[model samples]
Target: MNSTTDDTYAIAIVGGVYRERCMRPAWQEVYGSAGRAASAMASMGVSVELYTYYDSITEPVLISRAAIEGFKFSGESIPKSIIFDYDHGLATPRIYSFGSRQSSLRVQAEQVLRFGMLEGSATVHGKRVVYDPQSPAKPEPFRQNGSTADELALILNYREARLLSGGVSTSADLIAKSLVLDGHAQVVVIKCGPLGALVHDGKSTDLVPAYRSRSVWKIGSGDNFAAHFALRWMEEGKSAAESADLASRATAYYCQSKGFAIPEIFESFTPEAIVPSEAFRNGRRPVVYLAGPFFTLAQLWIVEQARKDLTDMGLEVFSPYHDVGCGSAEDVVMLDLAGIERADIIFAIGDGMDSGTIYEIGYARAKVKPVIVYCENESQENKKMMQGSSCLMCDDYVSAIYHAVWTACSL
Candidate 1:
């Protein structure tokens, strides 16, 4: 444990390190939460110390080590090691852990960071700690020995706050109050995804909007938000609102780049740079809306494949089947219409007689939106409609998506 002087600015990340397998865009292995945050902070000229378990005997641990080594921060400081072996599999927002150990380590620094339950029951006391309850499914309870009232707790969404309060309250004030009442934290931050985040400092709560990004690969966005907020609040002496705003910008940058390095423009970013209208607005890029029948397994799988292919082509996508699940009938209609309205182009799979998808195509055409229809087996009536509406019809899915991208860019 290192004692901090009044002017010392150092950060210590105490969590479990693992390898992430991204299914979107492509299947590739990358660094998990802890490693990503450490590298992100280090790239911003902050000295970071990582406390995690790593053993060469375990293949996952070895992979995690290799991933960390590939980052620029691997040579910044000597990482402390713990002797627990575990395999962490990250499937987007969800983490699958096997052989995870639950042991505590004494982390000494001005600020301490913890993400999920996989970090174990490490007791952090008498320090400015920042904790993120990673998932609502498996929430991490706060446990500590000594008393310190200056801590920040970050939640993925408002629903996850129930795990901390043991009650059913979604209000940011109530959640923050519940955490403070339970002696869990003094400050609480709830990340509302595209809607931005809410920060409560036990006195007042503020809502911070997320910045607009050109592309969004939402795997490690929360980790980047926590890392930036901790550094700005603890080291830079920024207010909670200011810290949350900066963190949102940093997260937007991460989501757009989907890389480890932070952009130099974010060093002096301002609130004026944010879109201010919507959190997930498109930035100088074409937005493609995917409309198809997602009722069956095969249909849903095809839609997902098309989404990934379009995403890889550097275009923003609005997949109603993936984004809007089997909700209420009214809710589904409203959500899908909003997505369609924001899109510059619509991609429809017209192979089968899907009434909902056909209606979507009609609505998009009515709005003067370009339509790209793909149907291997189409009827005469369907072909007549496709030709009448000036849609590019193709029998192949790949060719249809490529044509959609080209058509969208040309528009």
Candidate 2:
């Protein structure tokens, strides 16, 4: 809008800057909401600014990235969240929040800002509000932290939309329209993970299909999507629907390359073939048969956690531990086999190389069902035949689960 580029930034991200410690598959570093979004936008040569809260005492490696890819950062003094990211895909990263969200900032009209009502005390002078409800399950969370409805673009996942809109309908169009018509938002963007995204601007809704990446990296994906969308729609003045579609492609690239390589242009960039994976197509979710042992406490925990994880990801699961308990040998065998037959995919625990679990995997394979084995520390000799039979054996637990679901959804 103006030639005063030094005084005006194209995008402004207000979120967090904190430590992220991931376990099972271990990785420890400082990664935050605004920190990531700013980095991503800056990587693409966007003039961006980040506003966040972090421990000013220790002064963690906040943004010492490549010189050209660095953005302007304003950090509030706070011992912020130390998020524990575990291997259990179903579980949310446990945030050990130390400080209160008491901060303020000036929202310039020239800047495209996305604030989740983090600091309700701040004076927002922008034309539109960018709302991210943070988490749906926070203790009485969505209390309108600090957002206006007029000309608001609401970015939310399925759960947040459900919490705000009410009811249990999974249709993105219905949920988005309800928000728009009800005046919760002028524009509603429902991020449906693998099923793409729904962009609704009161008049109509469009489903921007998600491009399947070779390796699906879950961490910071939402932040990447939101930043790219802000750049395209808010900064560059693209339509909501077109911006959303472009954002989806950008997100796929982020996942595929883990934000290492930045494309020159968003519109012309095709990291890989844009193959859409419909996890839920025509109101049908592929059934997943969870085959694993429950003899020991450790074994039982894995099986239980995996079951919940798969279910939370919106797949109907037939877990032997939950679906069928202690029973006669003949009955258990028959029931488990029946479950396997009905399932579109089989996720088996191959760590212990349990006879029954192995049998289930073999049976599922014989019956032409897709099988994913989570064998973290099993020998190659032991899994040779299963591998030979074309079973997808994954050493990482999370990868195994995702592989199974993706395989099943594609099928």
Candidate 3:
């Protein structure tokens, strides 16, 4: 058994730490997953510290569980973050409008950095640091601020990377170069969901393939990847490739179990046992636009299942949910329209009167594209406008998919 004092390696996590509220299907409160990465690292038996700013609503339970110690700055009020997750769907939308509250967090991070320098303790001064810019808007504040650590890891998703790179390139190598050359950080990791991650270590880059899971809860998968990778590389004396492989497996476990805690089975897990999901399979196939409302868990599940089934039938699927999340209304509209324009056919789940799906149906019709509508419980009210010569309506999802496959073949 490893105690905090016995652990030679230590980690410092700096990012948004707040309370999260779910506003879809039901209203419930949960801890922020991204903010809880320190705890995850601590559970792995590495001494961990956290530098964050929080308010009264922030829970103290995770702090003790995940970190050996923490430094917190008090804000005027607690930031309220909301997530719209539906049954562990891949595209869980989030609204993290933290306003000006995040601006002060960088100051707290700087203080922690200075304190580490003054203390000069092995755990405090030599700790590997993880800076998780929770949003695209939050990166600028930390970009130029000088913070030093034994090794610094910046964890970001594709969108956040694009924002930081000024839309130049989303490549992990390019982002890392920008960060290193610009004096922002020494190492960069760009996590592309489902496709895995790109780890750039100043000189070289490695592509880590994601391990497949039967069910996916993508809420905190990237956080798990970043934290575990840092632990393995810094604490366990593993190479970049080895650390990333383990981190990928750890993320797979987190997603599969839908738990914030790291699983014991991941310690012995290897990539050889992984079987990539059909979505990750490479081949040329007709692109089908999966147009529907993912506002509910049931709807998101249906869309996800349809995507997998359609992909299994050798048809490429472009799902709006997979691409867009908590963006501007214009961005959402433009992205969906572009996808519809690229797709050969549209598969819409018309269980209810989803305005967005209805608009997609009309758009596809105007574009002279074939539209397949699937409604589980048939009703005359919902079928009036859908009854047309160009549309195929099916009560069963499988029937709709078969019709879509046949339609694609004919085209």
Candidate 4:
């Protein structure tokens, strides 16, 4: 048997095998999986220790253990924290090997057995376990066939607490409820994007509405919720029921706000722990400029596609062709130039490298407003002009459009 005086609960955070890609390494490496969970727990005044394991994607060999023990053996440490066991199919043997050979399944089974053994030991020893059964892949409406293989494995079978996190849409909420009804968890906290969370303990479910706010940027909102809720639950010694309510409110507060500042209630929950709604933060909308020739239908199509994509990422786009009418070349150039100067970032189509497009590129460069060039196909003249400009030369319009949106948002 393993033992220690650290006195903090060992929390594990799993899931996000695919989401790790969409986010920058800075988001993961700096705000690590374990670190984010710990941060959430800390907000509730809970001292915790966190453990994180990435799904699939083989890692380097390390020491193996047979005994199911606590952090004393695992070497993880934190205060009383929420354990985030993200339910990626990567953890189970049969699921991981669904499309592969039985040999791979055998290896996965051994790993799960070891994990279960260790986890069982930890529970038997003494530690409050909270499991976050979320994944990067969006949960589909429980397809009998698609989720069949996943169901047989029972990946989330052992969680005492379930956190509905990471892209929690309506479909995800239903799945979270099913997990609870199925006995995979004793309590369920459903993270409802702007609305808040729905928390359910075996007997009852409560809809905890979010604290209202003005500004919003939902980049790492789920991570923020997991951190604050976990901390508040552990530190305050609140019941799972109370924790669910608090977590929902915390997530809403963070999502409605901006920046990564840790909330104060996490350290010590006093009567004042529940703060006013206006305490949340805000963000300024980004300004965008779309420049290109207005003659060709193909070029017009590319511009429209770019507009749609940029709008999706939350930008106030300024395109003269759309705002004004797609008129003569001279009129479009004049309007495009004016829009370019007022904008923070410029995405110009270099399909033809028309004199106007070339002039706009030079103008954007002169203003230092980050110009991104999009070419429909390989044109020597277009390629030469795009060389020094912050551009993406692609074989087709779709690629160019995607590159432009990505580049513009990055800046």
Candidate 5:
């Protein structure tokens, strides 16, 4: 029986890589791509899972109701039938093929070794230095160790056995056919970057155009595209043509916005607005809310510096993590503390800022609080979130505080 009886359906992605030589970049690309797809799928209400047979530990963290099960690359637990999470309407039981099934830890280890390629060797400004090859450098015309035996064999065997034999015709063509013939999937899309995507079913093939963008990091874009398309397909439940079209539109919208790269989606957190009279008894000073994800080491330094900057500027600052005791609530909450509620201005750090911080921004703004939003990049999504409602956009925390303090004083 078809499992999608409810309003939503679960999708399992059983794709991953475990290359030995090109481990780091390979797995990084794979996980990064997959993570984007997973996030996109989540956005569209599809229960999604990625079962990668690699040892890399860079997979996306699943902290909410949705679960991403990571087994050892070759673990037996992964071979079971795909199933969706019934309670959450998440894709539970879908398995997408990646490579030879392997254990997760071993795959992770192999990924690390690939990452070690960064230390192999390189030339900088005429000085021959073994530059870290593992770092996501500009795509080179040729890959290192391209002539290795295993890679050669894998390629040769795949071409000879899979391509030459009666495996459809082209790899992508075969993949399109397999979506229907083997997986019983109704839609299949293969993205070709600038060339766009080629979508197909058993009967027909459609070529979709790629959206043009000014270039904000090109990492994980394909994953984002896939997830968007899959979820859209599930939601629309229309023809394959319509689903692919919606997928194309969604990818274009995401590419033009920041939700694909940075994780904060402010629309989801738009707090209930408060009347001017209900303002806190203690008058408003400016308070900045930091919410999104946890802080990275470098981001931590920036946050610390921002705190110092705000303190020097004589603005009252409240970081939920640093100042208030907050739990993992879905929406932001405003503490009944003295200075928080009456703040004249609100500041929020959007990138990976915890949920509490984000809530504070919404809470303050809902009360018509003047808000300043600072992010590392000038992402369109962040810009839109902070738009019109007394929010200022900033590149780094330093300028963010500066803008917030200035705006508050001017107000």
Candidate 6:
């Protein structure tokens, strides 16, 4: 008899429960995918059971938190992660992971209980399955061909989908459809950072937009989406698109509150839908103008990282330092101005209030290019003119990058 048939729990979440520590914006809490998802569903009034491995020292703490999350948990004592997430929320965190299941151990679904790289025909026998292959940036799971469930909803982040699809597809829609078209899943969802998600049900493919929340901490957001989707699509039997939209909304709530205490009436919440830049609709990506002073090592690091990060995120970036290396004032100014003219938006580092950066900000403003300034240690008086000019001044580094990308694209 499959344990899934019992009403003791609405869904079983099989994953890790790490002692997570995130910085940059300064967050001091601990939750792995399993704990985060279980907590999310439980808060939404769904009966959730978590099965996983945990550190013996934190077993008592896990039990106490599980009780508060309104879920039951059972797992073996094993070395777990003390993850330290950095300033880059979207990137992989530094994890001290411990598990000796080195050689891949195959497991038959037998009725759904999971996490780890244990890949096989492991979804529930007859139940609708919502599976997310990657957990925060855990080890890549061993690939096995073909999967089956009463209904399958396979969710993967951008990198995982690209890797799974062999990095051949140009777009998320293509990647998701390829997975479905091939037999990896009946329904596939590729999570694109700001562009939202691309969902492909064997028959049709669609782009579901991510909702805008006041604050965005991307650590366990994917886990929240997986949980919400599992509830709406698997338990309640909602349409794939509708379930994804609802899940996106719920994820926004998680980002907004930075916790898993989702309300039962979360559906009633309406968040602003992220609108991609008009150029994106036409398949043209907006160019980002990187404007900042790189006088010292720290300054140079930000400039370099911002350019690399933006470029890796699939944006056409024009960095003055990299593009126009050490040069005379005349040629550099001429080329820099031209680059700004070619760009749709600008990201300016206002730290130290460098004259050149301030000049670029003013130039961007005059050119009507959308500007996002990252200024952490500036006085309000110095920001008066920039603020009056309607520049989007952000104090946070990661947030500024995100703002620049989204702002540029939407322009």
> Which candidate comes out best when scored by lDDT?
6
What's model 3's lDDT at 261?
48
CA lDDT of each candidate?
0.66, 0.70, 0.60, 0.43, 0.40, 0.74
How far residue 222's Cα lies from its native spot in candidate 4, in Å, is 1.4
Q: Predictions ranked by lDDT, top down?
A: 6, 2, 1, 3, 4, 5
In TM-score terms, candidate 1 sits at 0.63
What is the alpha-carbon lDDT of model 6 when measured against the actual structure? 0.74
* lDDT of model number 3: 0.60
Give lDDT tens digits, candidate 6, residues 294-328: 88998998898898878877689999998987678
**Ten residues in a row with the worst lDDT in model 1?**
70-79
Error of 1 at 411 (Å): 23
Q: Which is superior by lDDT, 1 or 3?
A: 1
TM, every model = 0.63, 0.86, 0.57, 0.39, 0.32, 0.88
**Ranked candidates (TM-score, high to low):** 6, 2, 1, 3, 4, 5
Error of 3 at 107 (Å): 9.6
Candidate 5 local lDDT, residue 239: 48
Whichever of 4 and 5 has more TM-score, that candidate is: 4
What tens digits encode model 2's per-residue C-alpha lDDT throughout 168-286? 46677888888877767788899875567889998887888777666566677787777777777777778899888877888877765666336555546675433334435654788
* All candidates: CA RMSD (Å): 9.7, 3.9, 11.0, 13.5, 19.9, 3.5
Clashing pairs in 3: 39-66
Better of 2 and 3 by TM-score: 2
lDDT by residue for model 3 over 117-221, one digit each (tens)? Answer: 110111222345555565645354243444445566666776777777776764656876786666655667777643467777777887787675544455556
